[model samples]
Target: MMSSPPAASPQALLRRLLSGVARVFVVPVSADGQLLLHRHESDRHCYWTYPTMQRGTMRTDPATVARRLLREELGAESGVLRLVHVLPAARTHARSAVYAASLDLPAAEILAAREATGTSRRALQGLAVTAETLVALDVRPLAINDLMTTGGIPARTLLALPDLADPASTVNQPG
Candidate 1:
């Protein structure tokens, strides 16, 4: 029998567990509660997604992650953030906490902030368009991979069957 390699040390195991297990999604919304999605391009396809950042040294503080994402991505100070949903791994992503940030600033101001931070490359949507329009435009990005992967449907227009299980949840489910 071959000898087994050394087992992973507790420190290494803990490190692995702590790392790559958490990420945060910041969904900046207008005062009227419209989702502000940014353009995201992946190998699979281009889709709209909320600004996301990995959980850093402050592993337990998701709020910190949200604030940092807002500052870095939009170059704005923290807004009134409230937890909206917790999504387990969808596709290769780790667990994610979704926070809705209520921003009082105008879309032009937000765009300026992104430009000021030298992040003009990012395509931030103006407030006039709602998530409805994005979905209607036949663009469903990777964030909803778990659902799309299951049905092999890439867009809302193709999804015709309604789930009787939770009719309430299906209202906006592009899955």
Candidate 2:
């Protein structure tokens, strides 16, 4: 008689669950309360997105991924990053965690760093804009619209805006 296949191990199940589900996106806030956005060198549209990457089988947490992304893409660091939303995969193989992080550096500085670190394979142009500007732009990647309509962005993010208008304000200063 043929025997039934053994059940999958717990670790194996966890790995399968994590395989394509460990991606993250961030909304990087500048000192002026502007949102950091990226535009591909070959594309004409712009949209807000944090550094994102596949977790693969590394088993790292979302916050850790966000921190690594900040370091790799913007050459900056923050003491705290707040989770805003978790966007499940719509038609893709990966789900995404969204966070809100404040950067103490200038937009130009962050863009310069990104440009210096980015290779042809990941060529991107970084820009910072206020909420009004973001609304005016023809943003792409489609997920951004979902983030807005689905109430993914926390209210705290909007509360932080007024303080950004003042350059000397210490509202989002990193600890």
What would the TM-scores of all predictions be?
A: 0.57, 0.60
Candidate 2: clashing pairs of residues: none
Q: Judge candidate 1 at residue 111 and give its lDDT.
A: 76
- 27-64 per-residue lDDT for model 2 (tens digits): 77665545565554436643434457676577686678
| Candidate lDDT (C-alpha), each | 0.57, 0.56
Candidate 1 has a TM-score of 0.57
Kindly report which residue stretches of model 1 are placed more than 4 angstroms away from their true locations once superposed: 1-21, 31-34, 41-46, 56-60, 119-121, 130-132, 137-175
Global lDDT of model 1: 0.57
Tens digit per residue, CA lDDT, model 1, 1-175: 9999999875565444334548887767553334456776778776676678878556476767788788777776644565544566766567776565667676677776677778646787753343344445533334543332333322332132232222343434322
Instruction: Flag regions of model 2 displaced more than 4 Å.
Output: 1-20, 43-49, 113-133, 145-175
